[model samples]
Target: MLLAGAAVAAIEILHRRYDGAVARGTLLDPSARRDRTDLDGTLNYLLVGSDRRPGESGPDQRSDTILLVHVPAGTKRAYLISVPRDLLVSIPPAPNGYGGGSDKINSAYEHGGGGEAGVRLLSATLARLTGLRFDGAALVDFAGLRQVVDLLGGIRMCVDTPVRSIHTGRLFEPGCQQMDGTRALDYVRQRYDLPDGDYGRQRHQQQLLRAMLDRAGETNLRDDPVRLDRLIRAVGASLTVDTNGVPLQDLALTLRGLPPDGLTGVQIPSHPETIDEVSYVVLDDGGDQLFAAVRGTRVPGWVTANPRWVTRL
Candidate 1:
C-alpha cells in the first residue's frame, strides 16, 4: 500500500510538471469549423517551424519549415508532407488586416504579423492551395528543438555523404553518429552543400524527426519519471499550440499508439523555375494529385501510384 501511494504521488507530480512546462497560445479561432466526412476522418495539422530568435519581436520572422501532418481517425498511421518553403503560391487577402499577394508561401507568415496573424494567414494559404481544412496548428521554435535533442542525450543519425555547413563551418562525415544539440541544428540547417538544395534539407529534417520519434519510442517516458519530466518541460518551452485549448499532453496521448513504421514522409511534387531572377518551386500536376489524396483520405492509393515522392528514410 505504501509503494502504491508513492507511485500515485509520483504520477501526479509528473502530470503537474508537464502542465506547468507547456506554454499555450491561440493557433485557430474558436468559431472556425471544417467538415471532415470527405476526408475519411482525417485530421490535418499545420506544423510550422519558425526561424525567429527567442524573445525577438517583429514580422521579419519566416517559417523555416512547413509540414502538414495528417492523422487519420483510426490513428493507425500518420502522414507528414513537407511543403517547401519556397513554393510559389497565391496568398489570399490576410484575415489579420495585412495585405497579401502572390509570393513564396513562407511570405504569408511574415505578412500576417508573425503570431496568431501569421498562423491564420499560413493556414489560409495552405487551405487555398490544398483544398483541405486544418483541424489545428502547432508552432515549434527551433531553439526548443535543440534543447529537446540535448535532453534526449542527443539523436543518432546517418549522413549519406560528407557534408559541411556553409553557415556554421561544422563538418559531418558520411556515416552514423550521435549529434549534440548544436551539431544537430547545424545538420538540419545545411542546404547549400546538399545536392538537392532545399529538397535535401527537407529530407534531412524528416530524418531528424524520424530519429526523434524512434528515440521517444525506445525511451518509455512513462517508465522514467525524471527523463519524462525534463522532456515535457523542454517541449513546453519550445512549442505553442493554437488557442482551441488542446493540451500538449492530450495531443501526445493521441499519437502514442503510432508506430515508427506507420509514419510516412511525403514531398509535394514541384519543378524549379526562376521568376525575375528569384528561384521558386512551382507545384506540378502531381502536387494536385497529392493534395487530392489527402483531401479524400486516399493516401494509400496515392502512395502506391507516386512511390517516387515518398521518403524512404
Candidate 2:
C-alpha cells in the first residue's frame, strides 16, 4: 500500500490543483439504467475526447474520440472499447432541438449541443444502442492530452504502421518510438492514407491512451511530489468527468490499486457501408455479442473468443 499519509497528501494536492479545472456536467441517470448483476457490479464510463477544448465555446462539433471504458467487477482490469466515430446509430431527441434520426454516432455530441447536454445525449444514445448505461462520463480536451503527455515526460508510443502526418508533414515509421505532445496529436489525427481508415486512427488513439496509463502507473509520485502535482494539474485541465455525483477524491482513491497491465483496447466489429451518398460504419452481429459481453462483465471471455477484435497491445 502507498504510505497512507503521503497518499492522502498527494490526493489532497490533486484536489486543490484540480479545483475548477475540470468542466463538471450533469450526465448520468442511474434510475434509467439496467445494471446486470451477473458479475455483481460492472461499471461503464463513457470517455469522450474531443477536438474542442474544455470550456471552449463555439459552434457544435462532432466528437473525435468516443471510447466506452468498461470496467468489470473487482476493478482488476479495464476494456477500452473504441466505437468508430462514423458508426451509424439512432440519435434520440435532445434538449438541443436535434430531432431523433439515424446518423453517424459522433453526431450525438453535436446534436446534444456540445457540453453537459452533449454528454447526456451521447450517454443516452449509447445506452439505447448497447443496452448498458454509463455510470460516469468524461469529456476530454484534445489540447489537454498534449499537456498531460508532455508533463508526464511524454509517452512511449509504438506505431504499428507507417503514419504520415497531414498536418505537419512528419513521417512516423513502423516501430516503437518516442513522441512529444505535438507529434503525438498529429499522429492520432491522421486517417486519410491509413489502410483501415478511421479504424486505424481509432486504434492509434487507443494506443495513445494505453501508453498514457502505462506511463502514469510507472511514474512514482512519492519520490517527487512536484511532478505529482504537475501531473495532476495537467490531468485536471485535460479531463471533465461526471462520476454520477461521486467525489473525485474518493474516485481516485478507489482505483489507486489497479495493476499496471489493467487496460485492454478493443475495436468493435464493424464495416463501412454507404447510404444516401454518405459513408458510415455498420456494426456486425459480433458487435452485438461484444456488447452483451460487456453488459454482463464477460469481456475477457469475449476477447478470448474473438481474438481478432482485440488489439495486440
**Candidates' TM-scores?**
0.90, 0.90
lDDT of 2 by residue, 1-313 (tens): 5699899998687667676666677765443244432233667888888888656755477788999988877778888899999999988888667788999999888888876677678888888899887777888888777888887787898887887888788889998888888888889889987999998998898888878878877777769978777777787777777777667766666666666578788999999999999999999999999999987778999999998888865
All models, RMSD in angstroms? 2.8, 3.5
Candidate 2 weakest lDDT stretch, 10 residues: 31-40
The segments of candidate 2 whose C-alpha lies over 4 angstroms from its true place after superposition are 1-21, 29-40
Q: Which stretches of candidate 1 lie over 4 Å from their true place?
A: 1-13, 29-40, 95-97, 243-248
Give me the overall lDDT of model 1: 0.81
lDDT of 1 by residue, 13-61 (tens): 8678777776666665333325332233567888888998988748999
lDDT accuracy of residue 119 in candidate 2: 68
